[model samples]
Target: MDAFSEELMRSVEEDDQEKASVGCGPEIHLPWLSQHIQNTVSHGHKGINFAQTTSICLNFIQEALLKHQWQQASEFLQCYFQALEDFNSQKRQVALQNIWKLGSAILYHHPKSSVETFSAFADRMKNIGVQNYLKISLQHALYLLHKGMVEEAYRNLNQAESWRYGEMSASQEKLIKLIQAYRGLLDYYTWSKKRTELSKFDMDGFATSAATQDMHSYFRQASVNLHEIIKIPGVWDPFVKSYVEMLEFYGDQDGARQVLTDYAYDNNFPSNPNAHVYLYKFLKKEKAPEDKLISVLKILHQIVPSHKIMLEFHMLLRKSKKEEHHKLGLEVLFAVLDFSGCIENITAWRYFAKYLKQIMMEKHLDWVQEGWSSRKDWWPTFHFSYYLAKKNWKENKILALEKAFTSGILLGKGCKYFMYVSKQGHKVQEKSIKTMKKFVMKHNILDSKEL
Candidate 1:
């Protein structure tokens, strides 16, 4: 078995042994975790106290996280709370904090769900006098800021500041400082009308600071001081992102490049795409030698190999008319399609797929077709959906349409193939449609007109 499954088994066994030592009726069984939960919910009949039950639930939640099963963990959390409804509010508060931690841990992996999950827990926990309510509020505000909900983030951040008015612990003080820095960063970005989209690979952002050279210098000093006071790392943290933005706003490309380069090479921190992308943009802006630019592009594609990176590589290769780079770009794109099941930029995926289709069809590259078709990691990306719908494969088209719906493909955002599937009066699962509608409305995408 895999390491994750082994760890899960170990935890489950420990929980079972603990229960057995307490003379609890039969040990909680799983793969049938729900059955164990049901028995626990029956309370005295199983000799399982609330503490033991909570231990099992928490272990299961950890296992789910290890497996990257955020949706499953989310659903199980609801079941856990519902089953333990008779428990006191204090216990629930503790459970909510556990849930919050899980939510925060997975934010980079599953941002939308993480944001939704944490927001729900924060709303409930804040009212119950949870000590870390401000910390939770800070995270929620960050997610809101990520989504470009500036007004909402401002309100949430202000509310957290109000929460800091009473007597505070050291950790609470630290959280307040972090929140204030974030508030300053947000205000600067909002005033300058800059967008911040935090992805798994690109968690940091550069804020567009105010106009006027003197004002810029003053604001930069204050931001730097706040960052130092909070002890926010100069790499991988939000403060550095804002600092980079300030530098960029002042046309200080060298300063921004230094920060990004240092972060990229920081062995103590994980490598992120944004660092490399920032460095690449710097090199490009400076009109650096083509060799240097290509080297950075290769590094980006090697690390990420995402649709965006691959597409960018392809464009550079085509622009430079380099056969080797073209070949490398195609290979990288094919490899990305071979393994990636959860591609984020469906539009970019579509673009590459369409480009490949044109090339393969014109050149009659049967080998290329065979290789791609054989790959097991077949996510029906937007292009795949387009291909299926265009071919008039009714069942496959519907399935692709439903997948797109779940991926939050806005009504007008999707390609013609998706619109064709949607107008067919085909019934997808109600939940998928509801999710799509909510995403559309949330992003105000319905106002977009289709030709």
Candidate 2:
């Protein structure tokens, strides 16, 4: 058996032994217990403690979930719901919050059930006069959108927009704005698809049709709403992206660029990394100058050094023949390895090796060696340096010997294969390799194996 299965079996056996020692009987059938508790709660069984029974059912559901017994857990969940149905109005409000948490965990594993669960939950919330029912509708709409049910998602959003639950509180007001933003996004999606369909058949006919007029009206409304929405500083990525797309489609390139730039520079918004990412992507799409792209990426890099896109930017910098650009590319690669969780990126390591080779080719040996000294703590430097030394041994014997010796000392047993001794048995080569092996034995760096 695989290690994981063996470990799981061991753990289960240990747990059963512990339970037996504690006088707990054999495992109860969770599905049967769940149905029994649910029947008792539903039938209003006399003398049954509601709180204690509810707690026990919830505990069984959690145990079943830990065991990955989804069917049994689902049964226990229904029993918990039945118990909650008996709660008084004030208690029901608090109980609804707990149900949302538990329901999210259960429903996430069962998408087919989630559709019914979300609908039923929304109905329950609305019947209770809960203001968050609108938010729930919006969440349901987003889920529908993810499932590619655009028409259904639009219906949900439209229904939510019509909701009038007394005076709006501060939180509800924000929720309304979010709902409107989504509505605008849905309109954009619908309009874009219709336009694509019409363009393929009769563009002139579509331009003057009622559908075109409706699309224009939708566009105007979305543009106005998104303008106001973005003016209030926040990370409004979807709204901003939709707004920019609509503007670009309508032949407003300058407007789109301005919107992207303004969002990236918005001081009121907490420094959002995506804000800068949006601007960088937009500028790149526009075929902006290298300097402009570099400047924007520099800011983004400072905000999030580990961002994956930084690697692409590093390649862009490497295209330039300028020494400064090459140096910048090296720095970018180092940052990506150090901070981006890409420590084992072979492409990056190979790129690093190539860059060092270029520097070694162009600069004086003393200068290159000085740079190597500063970066000695990083194993890739020594690892790649050894390969470079072996490849160019005939042209630069002195440099090759130095690199081989240092790499052996730092790389330990891993560097043994890279240590080449010619059949000619040059005394200098033999002496250096021997000294390198001695250092490898005495001062080995742990886990410095080459990639």
Candidate 3:
């Protein structure tokens, strides 16, 4: 055994002793184990024996579970899954056996919550055998559907439908229903696309009749299947969206709104963010009352403050004349900036700077300074300064030029905005241009000739 394996084995032994003495199990320190596994797999360390490590980890997990240490067992399982992912890449046979063992363990302990996990394992075990083929097929079809491979998804589902499973469990029956739901979704997408194509061209009478019949057939399949499965919560979002879209496409605006409202406000269903997003978008499309739209967005924002559509919320607030609305709009922009990857988003920065400019013009200098100072370290300063310069050159010229020089220094010589500053410097008076050129050369921002 390598040092890591030996150390881990010693820890396991120490835990066994502690458990025997105290009549309670200790939680495994799994962070180190996870990190070790990742490092070993990533670096291809040959000294550590993974099979031995796997054996130790699995024994620890089983013991932890037997002692009613659910939390500890859960942690071990998470680490085990990480190891399994590594093994799947490096040792296929070991990974296959581990996948089976983990799946069996999950089925034995928590079958109810294991369906999704089992489906994921089954996807990995496709070349190997799965006892519950129907569940696997359903999951695979759903996977393909998400990837937009409609025909392949249909073929997978169709093959599963023809299978001769002797007796159906309740779970299997539910899988069949889900399969039908997906099939319906596929049909709806096909019909929608075909109708769009047919609308763009003029056809002869027979061709038009045939196309119409084909479109109707697809709609009938989608409608019947989706209607039957609409009440099945937890998996009804896609089906509901498709049904609402079909309703809207057919000019049944009332029906579409009703369906969206029901789904968005359903008490029994889990709180679904997309349900409200769907409602918000549909309401906006129908030009619903501003209050109604704001109400839905408020609920959604409370749930997920950093949702992408919060940009739309900000835009909506910007349209209002109320002072409170403008304040809320600025808050929305900051909220959007808090979202992941928005710090580097130029458009978000532009919105922030533009909104800040309005506040500056209103003589809210304190608020503008606070906002600008807070994000000065990382916000795209050049964009903001450029906007200010473009809008009012006399007042913001020095500020813009200074920001451009600093941005170029920090971002390196290849900074694109630096060139803009260099060009704009020549347009200034001789004294100001000379001062700016000296600052640029001192920083070595660009060559003198390029300037």
Candidate 4:
């Protein structure tokens, strides 16, 4: 029954705006405020006292300068923070988040760090406990990983995982498991150059298992991605290579290789160098003609000469073509020139440094004149494999993986290699996953998902 309401209604009816919105609301003026000041002096109200009371601050010299009174909008924020204490603690929490929005408007794009206000908010986060801990820790891990402090990220991830598990919920446990699995894959690739010897805690095993379980379903769902890879020359690109590698290790090389070859030309599979690793693995597993291995290496060199591992591939290639076993052995010997230094010698480190592709390609060849040495150790072997691959020191660029995987034979590190190598195993029918499998468990086998 205010005159404003009567006027607004009459205008709405006249303009047929009753059904349309103008997006305006009723606000009060001072004399207008006294008329109903008792009814509405809520924060946003513009009562009769509004102009006068606001002027009190405008009138003050020292205080007006504090806010650059020209930007009266900023004062709204001071009023906002004051209003929050009136609510109970829970609503007080929400008020703090809104405080950001309030500052966002008044800050006029000047990056204002309300450190004083944020400190209180941060304290609230700590008070909230476990849920907040997991969220904050996970975010921190993401930050560390983004900054390339992968080790720090994993450490923080461990803290987050602990918090999640402490919640004692099976659902939460699965979530943590999946996330850990994700981190493991990243960690494995990030540490691809550290193949000298795995850490005491076994980060290698952790990575492989995570990929196997979490990503097994990815093969089927990843078909679109696989098709893109097929467009590349050589039936094997990273995806196909991984698929074929996995199948062959599952005890079916011929079958995998056949399927891979069928799709080889259709999918633009690189028959020469890209497919060399699977071919070599298959050639070794099956008693195929040695000439086949030599042909692959020859094709490898023709395509890429910078391959540092060409020497190692030469060992296999020369031997494979030789009809007589004795002649083959001799040729293989000369092909592999014995560098005078050792397991950890600067010479070996040179190859390791030469090949480092981000993904593991292995060139672990550690020798000690007459005996074995740390140069051949699993971790360093992988580290160097990656290093040499980067240098393209071998024509059979992919063959660098041969020395890398084979070196794992000494310490039984083959399982770790198998995890990666098998992903591209030749046998598709055998290795092709039919449906998404749940991450059941983990073991030392390269067959399982560790990443």
Highest TM-score, which number? Answer: 2
What is the C-alpha lDDT profile of model 3 across 239-345, one tens digit per residue?
89889888887899998898888888878778888989999999998899877887788778877877888888887888877777777777777667666556445
Model 1 has an lDDT value of: 0.57
On lDDT, the stronger of 1 and 2 is 2
The better-scoring model by lDDT among 2 and 3 is 2
Q: What stretches of model 3 exceed 4 Å from their correct place?
A: 1-131, 140-156, 159-168, 200-207, 228-230, 235-238, 267-272, 360-451
| Candidate 1 per-residue lDDT over residues 351-410, each given as its tens digit | 554445444444534434444444423333433455555464344543454434422232
Q: Give, for candidate 2, the lowest lDDT window spanning 10 residues.
A: 416-425
Q: Candidate 2: give the clashing pairs.
A: none
Candidates in descending TM-score order: 2, 3, 1, 4
Residue 109 error, candidate 1, Å: 22
What count of clashes does model 2 give? Answer: 0
State which candidate has the highest lDDT.
2
What is the descending lDDT order? Answer: 2, 3, 1, 4
lDDT of each: 0.57, 0.65, 0.63, 0.40
Q: State TM-scores per candidate.
A: 0.43, 0.67, 0.52, 0.26
How big is the positional error of residue 248 in model 3, measured in Å on the Cα after superposition?
1.6
As for TM-score, the candidate ahead, 2 or 3, is 2
| Candidate 2 error regions (>4 Å) | 1-53, 66-68, 82-92, 104-118, 202-211, 306-308, 315-326, 339-347, 361-375, 378-451
Error of 4 at 45 (Å): 52
